[model samples]
Target: MSNIIARFHKIQVQDGVKVWYREAGAAGNPTILLLHGFPTSSNMFRNLIPLLAEHFHIIAPDLPGFGFTETPENYTFSFDSLCESIGYLLDTLRIEKFAIYIFDYGSPVGFRLALKFPSRITGIVTQNGNAYEEGLDDRFWGPLKKYWKSYQSDPVFVQSLIPYLQDPANVIRQYHDGVADIESVDPAAYTLDIALIQRSGQADIQLRLFFDYQNNIKLYPAFQRFLRDSKIPVLVAWGANDTIFSVAGAEAYRKDVDDLKVVYYDTGHFALETHVVAIAEEIISMLAENQGY
Candidate 1:
């Protein structure tokens, strides 16, 4: 794992915000950008990137306020800001087009990019990237809804959830509940992620951003419109055990895209960790089928 982290190149995106990302395979090869969700960083793809690198050029970046990226105090942690920042990162890398691996928060960010530049998106592979109404309702929804409604008035109460973000036991439970096969996960990976979460004020930013999530949820229809109008191919690689988003979210993609494929894995929210090999192969096959590898 240390060896994998060593290969990553830390690049600075817009506003001198240092974005930590890893690139592998040849530059001319088809690009696959892997975007991670809440509280996790590019570290989510540490085990998966190396495997996919063999087939395609892979780029995984720690989104602004997460992982090694420096989140300035003045920076607005809204979804629009995040989406714009990612567009800047792609421009900096000179990647004209790429497919995306979207998970959790990655769905909103990645979809925003696709909507902004429809011609730039070649394909999409999603793992629990919720887009359905049912996916929005969960055990966590009750608290998140309350917080979203009164975040400005009760900022400290919002901050109190930070402890759960730091708790290894709680984090592990999140993984276990989302993933189908828990044995495949490395305990050390969770430890490192927890350390990253605690190293900076990432937890605080995440809480603040939680209140702003409604801004992104409102854009879901626009994303669906993009999918319906565009001809880009899409694949849904879902973790059947995901308790947070549920399987209904996977089915929603079928409604918009003409060419939609579904691959259900026996894991939870972090399914890529357990099904990296198969997922990597699926990504390669999807690209080859679409781009003529």
Candidate 2:
């Protein structure tokens, strides 16, 4: 498995931001673009990508400010900017149509790419990526919501959250949030996140994305509209116990897409960490059953 995973590389997008990506699979096969969520990177997909590579081309790029992507000193960390950089990378690769695998923060960035090129998205796989208002539960998003409302005038909110995310206990909780066997989860998951966050100004950028998340919420209707109208192949596989993006958010995609294939995993926020085998199978199956799959 280690030998199969493509070595990571960096590319400068239109904005001059260096995007680090893990690309694998056959060049002629259907392409799968894996977009990561907050506090993690494409490394999270290390286990799943190779399994799918035998069937399709896979590209998992670290969004600017996270993972190996070099966080520019003054780069804008908004979702729009993140999408723009990815969009540029796609163009540079000459990729016109591909399937998008979105999770958490990847939802907004991937959804934006879908909107930008509605016809280009052959399909979409949403793994705990929420686009409906119902997905906004109280437990995890509550405090972040407060931070969003107050960060403009209250520096205290940002001051508190930055360290809270860096704290070892809280960071570990993110990895074990919905896992049934917390002990089985690797320590590397949280430790890797911590090492990256401590990189000079990484914490500040993470907080920026946490605040900008509200803007993604504002675009929920548009994202839903894209889903409803495009009606492309959409698979919703969610971690049932995730407190951050709840199971309700996972089911809400049905309002716009009636034929959506929704599956609930007995896990938490980072479902892939524990359910990679099942999740990979679902994605591979969906791509085959649906058109352009």
Candidate 3:
């Protein structure tokens, strides 16, 4: 497929957030809203967007506190707020109906949007985006779980975790871990992420979002209900070796979504780093099969 050039734009949302997004392809085609995960922004779609753009209009937005997107200091950095900003962006773009590609942090934001605007979401593409309890890997989440348990009573503990969470090494590990060939992973992706996270006040914003993640776990049931009830076509193109969200999470969708298609890649958390072409092909096939969605 011919590469389509992505254009960058920024729009101030209703909540005073300036959302930075990349757009490509013809507006008349089917739309794909790409919501990226933690530590990474719309830049994650840099490779995949062009491939998908051949068939669909692509909108990849950097969530607040992440990329070039500017968020007011007063703006609450929770998943709900993120969804609100994204929803407002969609409204501003006049996107009434579109498919959502959810990853990591994007899962909660996308799921919340699905819950609020059930009729608007045409389908879902989850890439390491967990909505199942079984998907949480205790090995990685153990400390976070402990922090969540003591969130109300222990300010000291939460403050102490700042170092580990904000460590550049950990950010690098997110892309390197679980992949067999480290050379295949691009340093630019994680390097850009590290630079962004090192910015003033960005760590605090990320920590705040981490604290708010407990609520996302609590809402899993509701997300599942929407999946079960809506019967929306879902494509689970996940990284099977991802230690953050296990393969079981990908399988769990079968229980809720009737029109589910699961494709597992051999890479790690950031599957697109190594498998963008295959993932894009899978997305095209899924869209072709569920054109009515």
Candidate 4:
């Protein structure tokens, strides 16, 4: 039995956002930066951390304005800003080089780092984190794309989306969308997300990221190029039932990365909730292959 215990931590980065992180495993073991996505923080990695901690050092951080991470006044919430902040956090911790485990919102943030400091990324493990245009399907992004059109001209239009985005039921839907068995879904996943959504200015911060998300899409080709030229090993573990990012997104990486392993689960966006054991097992093998263990 692995006796590792995940510890919650907080670190103040260069610009003063206190990023809350969870850490486990030994100090010198191969490191994995586990990053969570929209509406959730490092909290999403709760079940996976302890599983991976026995063999690898796992660090999962709540991005600025999410979870326990404090969003300082006047801080810009753009994806570029987030990448810089995450970079600072890594540097402050003396993490010279580490692999990234990305999901959803983390897809863009992790890719930015991989491109800027390709030498620092040992490998990448993506769970429904997209790197292609097809990943942005209409059903999930149609409304947000429309919001971007009138967010500048019509405040009324932006307000209309807020209620749905903030609604707990809607958040629950994001968690349960593709899962065939709703009974297996854990209530705490959306429960914690809804709590985080209730924080002051949380909705607006998310809206900023949503608006700036187009910037991420613009970098997809660049990300693909990095994967190809850098020859970075990748593990694409995805929920086959993911509504926002479909199975096609998982297959798209193969266009650039040849050293890739793909696995699909029957769950939805929150695959970890149901497939943590299986996912963690694959990640172990993936990291070992990268390190020649």
Candidate 5:
């Protein structure tokens, strides 16, 4: 059993936002930056960290508006700004060369980081992190696309989504949906998410960020170009059953990356919740083969 205990911290980044992050394993070991997705924070990696800490030094941060991270009310909550905050954190920590574990909203942020610092990235582990237009599931994105197009002009329409955003059941569904064994999911995950979403001004942050997600879609080609040009060793261990980001997203990596391994789990969006061990093993094997760590 791994003896490494995860440590929690809050650091003020260059932008003045206090970033809350989880760190584990030895500092000298190979680093893995774990970026999480929508409605969830680094907490999603809580179970996965201990499993991989023995082999990797883990850095999982709560994005500006999520989890324990403190974001000023006036802070701009776009994917670009999110990446900038994370970049500052890395620069402050002097983390030059490291792998990225991207998922959901993290996908865009991580890809942007890769584009900015191509040489600094050692490898990428994308779990339901997408970069292709076709990878987006029409059913899940249909309503979101409408919001993206109209949010600027339609005040009433934008306000209409608030009720759905405030619904605890919707948050619960994000954890329960597409999972064969619902009992496998820990309730504390969504429970904490629900509490955080209810925080003052948090709903607005999430809503604005949701709209800003359109920008991520616009950068899909750039992200793809980075993969094709960099050809960094990529491990695509995705949840085949994820409705938010379909299996096509997982397969899309094969076209651009020359060194890629795709492993599909029969789970949902948060695959780590169910298949943490297998994913950790795959990550270790991939890093060993590529980075000799």
Candidate 6:
């Protein structure tokens, strides 16, 4: 792993919420914005960023209330707020155009960004970021749905789930269940991820966001429409074994975007962890095929 600190930078967004992000690679190269899922920060891409940095400028931001970013008590962590925060980041960076890698919670935030500024999005790479109905089925959702219904009263029960997010044993299970080949994954990476999650207080935000997910689902059709109308190139690199966001969700990308190319890996939600080199090569190829190397 790279020894660099993966430095953090912050920008003030709506109502004084400070958003933090990490940047890597040459600024002159084509930009690739990596948006991470819940309970994880830009740290999720720590291993893959260096590889992609050789070919593209990479930016990964920790969404408000997650990771190192501080969120105010009055701030609403809605998809809209996230999108706006990202937009502010891009604007601050002066990145007029870029490609995006959307995963997990990253999907909703990136989708909203695309909707707001379609011209800024040149291409998209989706991994386990489901816009389809099939992606919602999983053990996680059962409790999530119940919690969503009664979050105001049963906050403690919801909060209790935070430990699971940082459990080493559970992280191992998540990797094994998600990856096509568990042996290929790096144990330290999982440990580091768990460490970061534990240190960041991200799990609490994740639980809060779980209840707020319906708001994003309602905007899915709008994202579908944006993709359909804009004709932006899309690459779907999915973990076929992902129990949370199933293979069916990968298939749904074809339904929404006209220029979608897909590659199904035998992994789960964190497919990039096990298939980093393959995913990087595929993304490079996709960008080259569309925008030239």
Cα TM-score per model? 0.92, 0.96, 0.97, 0.97, 0.98, 0.88
lDDT string, candidate 4, 1-293, tens digits: 36788888888896668888899999889889988899888988888888888788888989887889876799999989888888988998999879999999998999999989999998999999999998877889999888878889989889887888789888999888888888887788789999889877878888888999988988998898989998878999999988899899999988888789999999889999888999999998988655674
What C-alpha lDDT, on a 0 to 100 scale, does residue 114 get in candidate 1? 92
Between prediction 4 and prediction 6, the one with superior TM-score is 4
RMSD of each: 2.5, 1.6, 1.2, 1.1, 1.0, 2.9
| Model 5 C-alpha lDDT per residue in residues 56-164, reported as the tens digit of each score | 8899999999999987767898999999999999998999999999999999999999989999999999999988887899777887899988888988888988877
Model 1, 11: alpha-carbon shift in Å? 2.3
Worst 10 residues of 1 by lDDT: 1-10
- Please, what are the lDDT tens digits per residue for candidate 1 over residues 1-293? 11232257777776667778878777888899999987688888877877777567788888988877765678888888888888888999999989999999899999999988899998988888876676774675677888787777987767777786677777777677765447778777677777777765667677767878877778888888988998788889988888778888888888898988899988887887788888877887888765686
- Give the alpha carbon lDDT tens digit for every residue of 111-179 in model 3: 999998999998999999999989998878888999888878998998888887779899989998889
Residue 272 CA displacement from its true place in model 5, Å:
0.5
Among all windows of ten consecutive residues in candidate 4, which has the lowest summed lDDT? Answer: 284-293
Output the lDDT of residue 190, model 3.
92
Better model by TM-score: candidate 2 vs candidate 4: 4
Number of the predicted model whose lDDT against the real structure is largest:
3
Candidate-wise lDDT, in order: 0.80, 0.87, 0.91, 0.88, 0.90, 0.80
Assess candidate 6 and give its TM-score to the true structure.
Answer: 0.88
Error of 4 at 244 (Å): 0.3
The candidate 2 region of ten consecutive residues with least summed lDDT is 1-10
lDDT by residue (tens digit), candidate 2, 1-293: 32465767888875558889999987788999999987788888988988898888899999888898875677888999999999999998888889999999999999999999999998889998999888987988889888988987989867988778777778788789878799878788878887887788777778888888889989999999999899788999998998888888988888898558999999998888899999999988899555544
- Any residue pairs clashing in model 1, and if so which? 178-268, 178-269, 179-267, 179-268, 180-267, 180-268
